[model samples]
Target: MWHLYQFPLCPFSRKVRLALGEKGVSFEMLREHPWEARDEFFAFNPAGRTPVLHHGPKGITLIDSQAICEYFEETVDKSPLILGTAANRAEIRRLVALFDENFFADVTLPLLHERMKKRLVLRAPPDSKLLRQAMRLAHEHLDYIDWLVDNRRWLAGAQLSLADLTAAAQISVVDYLGGVDWSGHEGSHGWYRVIKSRPSFRPLLSEKMEGIAPPSQYADVNA
Candidate 1:
């Protein structure tokens, strides 16, 4: 068995969850609010972030979402999420950085801070200005995705890979806050529709948080 310490709405945590589910790796999810910075949780991850994967049999603890996902790809031979030749895999890693770093800092973090964390955990008012800026930035990222899918079957390449999982994880969190304006971006929307319908993604859609219900269409693949 494996144990995953994660926040309910963290994109990084969700990425690891999708990778684990895609590989058919069953694990116990222990919810941790990194914002709270609990002493015990800090012991698990000095960064005070969610998503620390613990392998019971090996007695190994994995920190950082990207590192954990790569470890899963290497250790779990049953299913392969990161595929293709070395060069192809490099492209996958590139897009993962695109979403995890650039897209996340510009769009996901602001919306998450305003829409989810502030209301649910911080119990503070949202910064409308920051939220608006984040929304504007999100459209740019969506357009970029639309352009990418115009040529490739998947975000990184022909096959499903960590690139798609990473992008979807962030976008899904934004969708939960009703931040994604799916209209006019048919290519991006269609890609997300397929990803959302996957069995691995079903559990994520089913999740609900108190005091901050997701929009009705948040879980709907058709939407």
Candidate 2:
């Protein structure tokens, strides 16, 4: 059996969980906070990150969300997340990188630092100025998502892929922190609604972080 070490609000961890869920892989969860800097956790990943996948009997440990997702994609044949033509696969990878890097940096990371880490670790009030800035950036990102949804069936192409999982994971975290403003982005909002309704996304919606409460609409698939 595989044990996934992750905290509730970790977007990368959520991405891995979504991929595993869609691929029909069963694993146990081990809540881990990277900020705690536990020695045992560091042993599993020298970088000391969450979402480390460990197989005790097989002695296999996977670190990094992209690497772990790819590991499963290659090994498991049930659901192919990076499927389609080479161009389509490339598009999937590109969008995955966009969400995992650009969107996270512009929106999710700021929200995590201001909303989550501040409240939990620093015990300080969130910065309103920074929060506003993050929300503005979020709108920008959502605009791009709106454009993509308008153009394609999914973020990458026709079929559901890792790109959708990656974007949804990041967006879910932002929405949890109350950073998303879906007013002008109907296309993105509709797309997100569909993603949120997926069975693979249900577990994430039900989970919560200590000292934090998601907006009521965060868990409502119909909203």
Candidate 3:
């Protein structure tokens, strides 16, 4: 059996979970907060990151979301996420990196730091300035998503791929933190609703972070 170490709000972990779910791979969840810096967790991943996939019987440990997803993509014959021609697969990877790195840095990370980390780890009040900044950046990111949705059936192309999963995972975290503003981004909003309704997404919707209540619409597939 595989054990996945992750917290509810970790977008990278969420991405891995979605990929695993789509590939029909079942694993046990083991919550780990990297910020807590647990020594035992480090034994799995020296970087002390969440979403470490460990298969005890196989003695295989995977660190990094992209690495884990690719491992499954190669191993599992079901639901190929990084699919299509060389160029098509490149495009998928490009968009995945865009969301995983750029979107996370621009919108998701700010919200997590100002809202989640502060409230849970620091026990400090969130800064309105930072929150507003993150929300503003979120709108900009959403606008780009809107453009992508308008042009392509999926974020990368006509078929569902890792790009969509990666982007949605990051956006889900932002939405959970109440930093997303769906207004004026109807294209992206509609696209998100469809992803939210997928079977792979249900577990993520039902899970919650303690002491941080998500908005009512967070769990609602229609919203």
lDDT of 1 by residue, 71-156 (tens): 98998986677788999989999999999999999988998889888887778999988988998999899999999999999998
**TM, every model:** 0.97, 0.98, 0.98
| Colliding pairs, model 3 | none
What stretches of model 2 exceed 4 Å from their correct place? none
Off by over 4 Å in 3: none
Score each candidate by Cα lDDT: 0.91, 0.94, 0.94
Q: Write the per-residue lDDT of candidate 3 for residues 60-133, one digit (tens) a residue.
A: 99999999999999999999999999999999999999999998998899899989999999988988988888
Our tally of clashes for model 3 stands at 0
RMSD of each: 1.1, 0.7, 0.7
The local distance difference test score of model 2 is 0.94
**Cα distance off (Å), candidate 1, residue 51:** 0.5
Residue 132 miss distance in model 3 (angstroms) = 1.1
| lDDT by residue for model 2 (1-223), tens | 9999999999999999999999999999999999999999888799998789999999999999999999999999988999999998999999999999999998999999999999899999988998888899899999999999999999988989999999999999999998888999999999999999999999999998988999999999999
Best-to-worst lDDT order: 2, 3, 1
C-alpha positional error of residue 131 in candidate 2 after TM-score superposition, expressed in Å? 1.0
Clashing pairs in 2: none
